[model samples]
Structure formats: structure tokens, C-alpha cells
Target: MAHHPITHGRAGLNRRTILATGLLGTMAGFTHRPAAASETPPFRYEVTRSDTEWKARLTPAEYRILREGGTELPASSPLWQEDRDGTYCCRGCDLLIYSAAWKVSVPKGWAFFRHSERDAVLTGIDGPVPSYGMSPDDDTTMIEAHCRRCGSHLGHVLLVEGSVLHCINGTSLRFTPA
Candidate 1:
């Protein structure tokens, strides 16, 4: 038995197991998880891979956040504040999209770039109307951006404050020094 604050008249929760499951639950990949797939809107990418291949190619967290359509916790990625001279590319495939010079530090808690190479990434709806998760008030509708070449979920793009916020997941990007 362990002390946990989250309670709803549940009994006999193994501490480690519960904690691990709770943590994993917060993470979803770019693709739908089995639990959420039924509610997920139809989407397709030219590039397809078997679940086994994607699992093997990505880390557990990456697969969850990229393929399972899970989200990393806010402020969890160091790249949110990363300002350096380099190129930011897709983690799933080494395709350069944004330059370091245009990246901005926004309070959104993800990598915010002013723009990207138009041809390097594909922009599309992440879901149906009210396309964002939960409520439009909490998670507003935004366009999802993925690797045009690999079809890997990068993050999202939206117009905010007269600038296009290329809010990318840290797990979805790899930085290369110029």
C-alpha cells in the first residue's frame, strides 16, 4: 500500500503499476491508440508502416507521442527554450524544416518556430471540426504538420499574434548544428 492523492473509492492499486500506467496514459502517438481510435477522425498518410516496425523504429515515448497521437507534457521538452544556430528537422526522418534563426520562445511550452520550408512539411487537419482535443476553449483547432517525406507527426501550426506558430513536439524533432 502507498499514499496517493488521486482517489475515487478505488481499492488495491499497486503503486508502481498504477504510476506507470498513469504516466503512459498521458502519452499518445501521432496515430490513434487503440483506446482512442474509435473516436479519432479518419486520417491517412502516403507513408505507412506496420505497428511492429514503428515500435522498433521509435522509443516507447516517441511511438506513443508520434504514432499513438499522445501528447508530451507541457514544458517537458528542452527545445521549447532552445535558441541556437542550427537546423530543426523531423525526428522520424531527417528532413530539415525550420532554421534556428526563426525559432521563437513562446509560453506555449513547445518548440515555436515562425515558419518552415513549405515543401518540407505537410499541413493538414488533425481531426474533425473542433479538431483539437477536449474543448475548443482548452485545445483549439489547429493544423497538424508532419514530415512531407515520411508522414511523421511533428506537432501543429496556428496563427497566433499575427505569426504562424509552428508548435512542434520536442520528441518529434532532431536538431542539427549548422
Candidate 2:
């Protein structure tokens, strides 16, 4: 007896069906995959030899975040709602981060679209991970902010959808009136 193949209107595992099923499985696998353990934590400031001297120069909020592990109140930062022609400098070191002309308002609290070329505020990944764990549904760009002078925690660099990362709410941040 010969084995007859089932003829059901283009049956016997079509290429399109196989590819579709494989793609679906891959998407499902990725969708339910576990997230990584690396997560960005809240902004915490560290001290240096000159930190003591800088602390004397900063305000209470600046000291709390740049020197000690602290977070500034949301919408409480004057820079968040600032609409002036000035620069945003490090509260701990007075290094310019944002230019008086580059500041702009965005949704993620106080948002700045540009940074000064000589500004010291920048992102570093070698720092410790934050307390929160990575979320599978969230983006995976870890940003670390440090003082330009003492390398203290001014706050965090939030990665926006575009190539823009807003550095906001760090305790070591201060705005200078131009």
C-alpha cells in the first residue's frame, strides 16, 4: 500500500503558515521574557575632598541630593518652570550644564533640550545601579550624572525617546540668572 499525502487545498505545512507561526512564537517569547536585573536608582550625591567646601556654597536642597542620598520634590525645582535667559550650573560645583538659550519645557517635569559645551554635567555608566530593577516593558538606557568638579550626584540623565536625555531634579543642580 502506498502512503497517500492528504490533499486539502494546499495543505502539508505551507511555507507562509510555518513562517507566520515561527514569527508569532518569537514575538511571544520576547514579550514574556524576564527583564534584566540592572536598573537605574534614584539620584544620590557623593562627596569629595572639596565637597565640604562646596557644601558651604550650596543650598540645603543641593546639599541633600549632591552630598547625601536625596531626591528633590517633583515640580518643586525652580528650573523645571524657569523661563528666563540664564544658565543651569551645578549646585555643588557651579559647572554649567544648560545654556540660557537651550532651556525648554517638556513633559518629563523640567526639561532642557540643550546643554552648554563647557558644562560639566554628563552621563557615566560605571556608577552603581539604582535600587529599582529593570522593567521588561521599559527602555534600557542607564544614565549616571556626576558633578563636573567633585563628581557628585547632581541627579540622573533621563533618556528620552529621541537622542535627548534630560538631566533634572538632582540636588547638586543650581540655576544662574543671566
Candidate 3:
């Protein structure tokens, strides 16, 4: 009697078992791992406010985007159509974040700027938490911009057309004519 290579001497370990084990092992390797505690110290901004105070000070839309990291509807903000000499300040803490000089016309319907005032915004990687079972190698991460002084959620920093764009939420800003 000739024995098949895959069915070795009736040992009961067959190709299906080997393949299923390999598949499960590979899946286990990709299972989500809880994030370790952050090693870096948390940032302390120049301005801080209580949640109640922030909600009281900001409009519902402003609070949603500035405090909750939510996004405004595209083209909904009149600031997207604003073309004037002015500065844009954080609505949360009145901190200067962008300049009209840096503003650019982009079809994205959000307030787009070529850059921001020096040190006016801090950027960090924002994305879905890995604990949500997202793949570690996923490219869903985005560069989130925040108010340097108040640490409010501003928008995102993106590379557009070989230029660094500070794509900001107009609802999160208060425009001041320069």
C-alpha cells in the first residue's frame, strides 16, 4: 500500500487540519492588540477650559468640531468663499491659527490654506484606534491640526498639489479683518 504525501500513515493529521491551523494562526497573528500606555507626557496647552465652559462659550456647531473632533459639511461654511485680508482665530480660545495670506482656493469646499501662522497649530497623527481591530498597516491615518494655544481640534494638514495645505474648519474659526 502506497501512502499519500499529505495523508501520512493514517496519523489523522490531514491537509484540511494543517491548512485550517495555518489559517487560524495567521488570523490570530493579525488579531488586535490593545495599545500600550503612552510613554510621552501629555501636552499642556497655554489655555484650558472646563467642558461646561467650552460648551457654553461655543455654538453647537463650533463645539461639535472644536471639542468633539467632528467635521463640518463641505461648502457649508461661508469662510470657504471668503477672500479678504484677515486672520482666522480659534473660536474656542481666540488664538490666532491662520492668515488670509496663506489661504488658497481649493475645490474641497473647506477653508484651505497653503500654510499656517508660525507655531499657531500643532499636528499629530489621527486615525482609528487599533483596538477597533484595524490592521496595523492600514493607511487610514491622517495629520490632524489642533490649536496650539487651546488644543482645540482645528482640522487636518494635508499635502495637496506639492503644497502643504492646512485644511481647516471654518466653523472652528473667528475671522478678524487685518
Candidate 4:
């Protein structure tokens, strides 16, 4: 057989060329992963300013948590040790959620209960996730809350075992202290 190379410099492609192309695509994906994965843009919770005006309605701790996105220290919430008769309402908008008869202690300072009263509170939806504990766990529920009129992020809710749910402080709600 005779070789015909008069018209071209190269005869055929090689394995290295194909491997290099694939490697370049993989590199591109790796470079962009972090930028996409860690970016959570900020969102507005409510239209009105509920913090300053409502200071008098909450204790110092509730004001810090509900107005500043602060978390109450474990075993420090008044609700953890409270034994009273009243409903818990948002200090910001006074939207009621829990009745005094429903509070339960689970070693976490905040209180847990079965559910919220209809028309007394609103829940925002959380979508599906891929990893362990990425979404709310079987004992936890996640929801964005707001006054029906104000759209505030009152706090997050986590459903617990035996149908109990915890409404943690989220820098936008307060109890009436009664």
C-alpha cells in the first residue's frame, strides 16, 4: 500500500485531542460551581418597618430576635419556662399563632405546639432538596411567615415528632408576655 499525503499535513485525529476537549469542559464546570452554589440573594420580608415602632410591645430578647434576625440562647426564652394562659402574637403585627394551653417544652428554650390557628397566621412554602437535613427534617417544618397585611418574616417553623411544631424566633415576631 502507498501513503497519500500530498494534499494534507495531517491524516487523522488522535486520542489526546478528544481527551483534552473533555478535560476543558470539566474544568469550566468546576470553576463555576461555587459561584452558583453559595449565592443566596437577600429578600425583603415585609413592606413596613415593624421593628422601631413595636419596641414597646416586646421584651429585650424578643425585640432582638424578631427585629434583628437574632437567635435566643437555648434555655433562655421566657416561653421555655412559661406556664400561663394567652396566645402568642407577632410583636410586629400582633398576628396570633399559639394559645397558652398548647405550649410544650422540649429542652430548647422556645416553645413547640401542634399547629397554628387558621387565619391567625400565614405560612410560606419551602421547596424540595437533595441532601440530608437540607430541607426541614421530619421533626421540623420551614415556612416564611408574615402578617397577612404586612408580609413580614415572623419566624421559621419546624414540625416535630408526634405532630408537634416549633415556631422559633426569626427577628420579626414577639409574644404578648401574658
Highest TM-score: which candidate? Answer: 3
Q: What does the lDDT come to for candidate 1?
A: 0.76
Local error of candidate 3 at residue 64 (angstroms):
0.9
Query: Please, what are the lDDT tens digits per residue for candidate 3 over residues 5-120?
Result: 44353334533675767765655575475432332346689999999999899889888999999999999899988999999998988888888998999988899998888988
lDDT of 1 by residue, 35-69 (tens): 32233455565567888998898999998877766
In candidate 1, which residue ranges exceed 4 Å CA deviation? 1-48, 130-140
Q: Mind giving the per-residue lDDT tens digits that candidate 4 earns over 1-178? A: 1333531223224235646577656554555443321244444444466456657776676566655545666665566666667777666666776666777666666666555667655666543332456655523434644455455445556655555475555234355656
Worst 10 residues of 3 by lDDT: 1-10
List the global CA lDDT of all models.
0.76, 0.59, 0.82, 0.55
| Pairs that collide, model 3 | none
Q: Which stretches of candidate 4 lie over 4 Å from their true place?
A: 1-47, 50-64, 125-141, 170-178
Instruction: For candidate 4, give the lDDT of residue 7.
Output: 19
Give the count of colliding residue pairs in each prediction. Answer: 12, 4, 0, 9
Which lDDT value does model 3 have at 175?
94
Per TM-score, what order, best first? Answer: 3, 1, 2, 4
Off by over 4 Å in 2: 1-60, 126-141, 161-163
